[model samples]
Target chain A: MSRRLAAALRPAAAIGCALAAMAIALALLGASPLAVAADLADGAFGNWIAFTDTLARATPLVFCGLAVAVAFHGALWNIGADGQLVVGALAAGALGPALAGAPHTLAIVAIIGAGGLAGALWGGLAGWLRARRNVNEVISTIMLNFIAAQLLSWAVHGPLMEPSGAFPASRKIAAAARLHLYFAPTRLNLAMLFAVALAAVCELGLFRTVPGFELRALGRNRRASAFFGLPIARLTVGAMALSGALAGCGGAVQISAITHRLYETISPGWGYEAIAVALVARLSPLGVVPAALLFGALDNGSQAMQRADGVPAQLVYVVQALVIIVMLAFDAAAGGGWRELLEGGAPDRPDATAETCDA
Target chain B: MLEAFAASTIAMATPLLLAALGELIVERAGVINIGIEGAMLAGAFAGVAVAHATGATLAGVAAAIGGGVAINAIFAFVAVNLAVNQVVAGTAIDLLAAGVTGMLYQRIYGATGRAFTVAPMRPIALGPLARLPLIGRALFDQSALVYLAFALVPAIAWTIGRSRFGLSLRAAGERPEAADALGLGVYRLRWIALLASGALSGLGGAYLTLAYADTFVEGISAGRGYVALAVVIVGRWNAWGVAAASLMFGAAIALQFVLQAAATAIPYQLFLALPYLLTVAVLALMGGQADAPSALGEPYIRA
Candidate 1:
């Protein structure tokens, strides 16, 4: 078979394997594999609302996925996206009242920008520590996630507490700050377009720009990148900030377009799940779209499964986790990228095209 | 009030100390499992489920250890044998734990969430010592797990510091290939270290469900495992240091509880964030001084 065809067929085959595995697990748990599979499909794609829900879910995943993709490309791990997303929402929510009298378009832009800034700062904090103090990114980011969660809780319950003090959430965001919805009653909005546009921009910048070159070089080898005159510290921090900006944008868009209010808990582990999304996409900006959609389908279908099939919605996490394990293990074992996985067993292939290094 | 705070400090620190000790052992043997969070979660669920079903606290604790070891076995296979990326494998295990635990919890309880509780392990008093003045009950009156954890701190310190086996453990962590050449059996040592870590972490998880929280909730471990990682770092890879750091963190968390009870206008969330913020602050302050195992996180594959 031709390389492209084999590559295209690879993910489908891998996904099939994952599904079969999940089915066996389900069967052991006393649930019928066929019924759950049918339930998942019907829930994710059966109706217009479900389809819209999948797209809406995919929107945040795309932004967050890109966030991970960009950072991983630079060899930085932004595991704190959950925290960044929360901070983004916090920024946007805090700005809602101040923007109450502003023009609609300006208010929307400001809110989104604020969210991105908050996330950038949160993400940049980890980058700064890594570059300056040589602290590991993984532990730092995880700590930051905890801090962010507390901060969000405080914001909702204390400073931004609803006027009546009844709920741990902010007042509804100014109507003017809300994104224009494309589908009536469906949470879908122009944010989806923005997410895709930003992804396209990332794709171009990563492959076509000097800064992107620096980032990818750093990811490939820190010593080599520094040897080649890259401002290792600045690039490390900058790449982290940029990655965080995307995650912040996700938070901004979600608050502005969907929930329309900031609650105590803004995300259900979207930041961590985005790691799986980015990896499954091989950290490619373009690939993130389809990969995010797959995760999106799982999430959306999970809700359906819970409601109809009596399965817990968290089964989605199981599936995503499985995919991450298999994908990473596959990458490590084969010493190649997504294409290699799809190409069956091409051991001798150069790693030039592989998305993420084992490091 | 002071005694309550002191007692609570020990209670809160018990889990962190236990898990941090385990992680310190694993790191000393050249493996880093970020999935410590998942292992704790599995233990928590297993502990609660078994305790609830059998009405035996001891059985629940034992099951928790079994559950943790079983989960870590997967980590051992992928991270040790397959030699995959440790972070990815660890992360996958965490996600798997989250999913499977949630599914199991839901399967038992049904669609709508319901409470699952177990009788807490009764505290064991050091008879005469428990009656001492200020530090009496806080130190002498505690559960079996707390005593076990603190006792193991010294024991581990001795094992990893003075014993001949300790030399092999450090050798495995610092330079695995050399250790292998010396017939130190690097892989076997690493595997054993991980199993020990898993059992300790399982005990920590059991403490959360059966000793302190006395309940099962999704994500109940609540990043304690990660905090344990930070504790390991802040402790500078020493058993005594780990104990000190864990207690300091425990105090910080215990104060949060106190502050929340005080009902101050200060965003109570700020109080909640104290431990995490302290972790970052400690990392920043420790910088470079907090050395780690040289070969930590590298997957060992036989050539």
Candidate 2:
């Protein structure tokens, strides 16, 4: 029990230090750090509507975070989730207009399926390169992001372009295909419920299945897993494809729930931002929920920080950097100092191990 | 028509070649510097900002080198000493550089204004080499940076293949433990390689601001650094091969521009997507089971 308490406290202490350091930096930059923090709190939770907005913003983040966490657990770095999300949104957008006369339920299903398939295909390509050709997924995924961006730009500017054609975005999806809002006067829609359900499913799949065990084994040591007769190549590809599917679903949810249209910049690096979420969550499915919500709040409140205190929106990114650095630092220090702590009449081994695993 | 294509292709390929060559060297020495994008961005901003400030093109070029190296040093500390994941560290640096440069630009020049421009580097006549008809303009009549990019290909190839220092560097990358056992310093070689890569990548960034666009803009590197990374893979990790691959991509990009200029029925945006599309296609086809350095992404800690 004491060990568990220490494990929880260690991360909290590290985070506290990180927050204090960021506050100092913000103050040094001539911004009222306290005011910015206050604004963030107010914007995120000062009212019921504001809190709903935070939840709405967190919807896509939840999907992307889980997508990243899934692949990361398999030791596959699917960095192209951003590109996958865009492609997914593009496909869903196209499907919505084409199937406008279809039955409502059918139209929604088609749009979601189309988006997932698009993301899966994009992600599968990276897996194919990694498994068959030994191309680094990191390089391939980054390259694919540029390709996806260009494809969206072309689509919005050409074939699927809105009639006005002044901006690079597609026409709004049919009303029948849009996700219904569960809460009136807020952007919160069925997507949040879907995200929560998906998170629950992912948690089960990861912790309770044979495939999950294989994936965890692969992540821990591919060579050893292979020696134990796991099909490493197929697993890597499968994991990446599934990861992409989730990210694509994220895009579909965004289009149906909020945007209602396919814009060229559908995601403002939401897929990339998912990396931070997954990392902060230590790639745990259960952990991703709170991490995504926290990040969503930070992102949503950043504008308020800028408006209320003249703090640059870029300061959020600085905080994210500091968070990652501090997390890693704390994990390392805790692990290294564990032996000393144990000798000094404190139980530290389990806590140190947990912290290392989180990292 | 072919002559025009070839000329523009060479012009387009110059920056990629410079950047890819730098990345190839650093990767060859075992440090996967994902911060190439950040380095390039820094160099691009510094190059343009200095030229705008000093009005001397040379000063701008020098400042770009300084900027690139400065960014790279930060990455080296995080990745080398702190043992942070290289990809994460690199991404952070890229984000930091993007945000910082964007803010600095806005602070200095204000939001609503056209960026300052610099005089582009003029092509040098190679005297006898300039007399050749079709090939001359394609190869000889190019900026100093263009020629330097081409020259570095063979120079890097020779140095990596033959030099004593190159052997030590390769040893460090291939098997750091073995290299350490043999009394070679793994850290030092990686540091030197990163610095050299910074200079070359910085030059690549300078090419954009000083030659291509002749002005600064947000995200102006426009994923070129990442493209250079693909170029290294498509080039099969060889310096000469990297040069050839860069030229191919350059030609692809130049063709898109030409098609746009000619106002073809096909959307110009599709044309813009061609290079990236080709990069993926090339990787799919050619990147087959090639062996990377043993310690490519792992940081060495003395245990």
Clashing residue pair totals per candidate (backbone < 3 A): 0, 0
* Interface RMSD, per-candidate values to 1 decimal: 7.3, 9.5
Alpha-carbon RMSD to native, per candidate: 4.6, 6.1
Supply candidate 1's per-residue lDDT for A60.
Answer: 87
Q: In terms of docking quality, how is candidate 2 classified?
A: acceptable
In terms of TM-score, how similar is model 2 to the real structure? Answer: 0.90
Candidate 2 lDDT over B1-76, as tens digits, reads 7777888899889988988988888877777777899899999999889988998989999999998888888777
Cα displacement (Å) at residue B292, model 1: 1.1
Place model 1 in a CAPRI quality band.
acceptable
> What value does the lDDT take at residue B102 in candidate 1?
88
- What DockQ score does model 2 reach against the true complex? 0.28
TM-score of chain A of 1: 0.92
**Residue clash pairs of candidate 1:** none
What is each candidate's DockQ, to 2 decimals?
A: 0.45, 0.28
Best by lDDT: 1
Q: What TM-score results for chain B in every one of the models? A: 0.97, 0.96
